[model samples]
Target: MVCAVIINAENKRIKLCNEIIGLMYGYIQWNSYDTEAGGIILGRENLGNDNLIFEFITKPMKKDIRTKNRFLRKDSEHIEFYKQLYSKHNGVYAYYGEWHTHPEDIPHYSIIDLTNWRKISKEDPKEMQYHIIVGRKQLRIWEMRKKCFMPKLVCEVKWDEINI
Candidate 1:
């Protein structure tokens, strides 16, 4: 289990649980032919403090489209998983954002990522959404608000930092 706390510009802490980190690390694109993998992020809000705790994430399903450089989630399983968690937790566990792997040492969001994030932000009921990109050597996290047009880089955690 490897956990990390990311402090945003506003001094708010976004905590990533060990299980969530481990699951994403398992899908990192390590080999040349490895394709992208992705799923939805789910977590609970720290009421009163406004901090976020990311404790769960869905795994890529069989219905997802995958290529060496692209990943398209076409699986309804992801949504089904979310619904189950939401119900099990009585709405405490909510959608945080999306996560995907990038075959690079340090990943940057592509144009498609930006556009998709924007659309999700506009449509999601949550006021804030957080996304993550798992790279070969790092994990980059971004935060997007419903009223914001672009997602802002919140934090980057190197593999070494997690000591995984």
Candidate 2:
């Protein structure tokens, strides 16, 4: 399993499991025809610490909107999956944030991405959320606090580093 850890400037850490990372890697925009794909991030917080361990993520469903440059998660299955995990795990598992693909060598959050993330931060029950953008060669993660106006860049993981 591809185990990876990312620590932000604020000393907050996030662990990405192999399965979820692998699934995300599959949706990287590799070709011209490739479109964006995205889903929600679900995981648990480490007790007595600010660290997080991401264990699950929903995959793109038929109801989702996909385009070469945009991805809108319109599927109800993602929420259903999150509900199931939260229920099965008895609240240990929770929503972390959103993830999507960007057809670039190095990804940066677009205006739309920022707007949507801010909306999520305000609406999601969790006080902290993490958003990930998978690029052609790397993945960038951002951390957003519900009370904060802007999300901070947590860390960036390169595709080569994962060796997938």
Predicted model with the maximum lDDT: 1
* Poorest stretch of ten by lDDT in candidate 1: 1-10
What are the lDDT figures for the candidates, one per model?
A: 0.89, 0.87
What clash count goes with each model?
0, 0
| Tens-digit per-residue lDDT, 1-164, candidate 1 | 56655656465778888888889999999999999999999988787887788888999999999999999999999999999989988889888899999999999999999999999999998788889999999999998988888888988988888757
The runs of at least 3 residues in candidate 2 whose Cα sits more than 4 Å from the true structure, single-residue gaps closed, are 8-11
Candidate 2's TM-score reads 0.92
**Reference-based TM-score of each model:** 0.94, 0.92
Residue 107 Cα positional deviation in candidate 1, in Å, after optimal superposition: 0.6
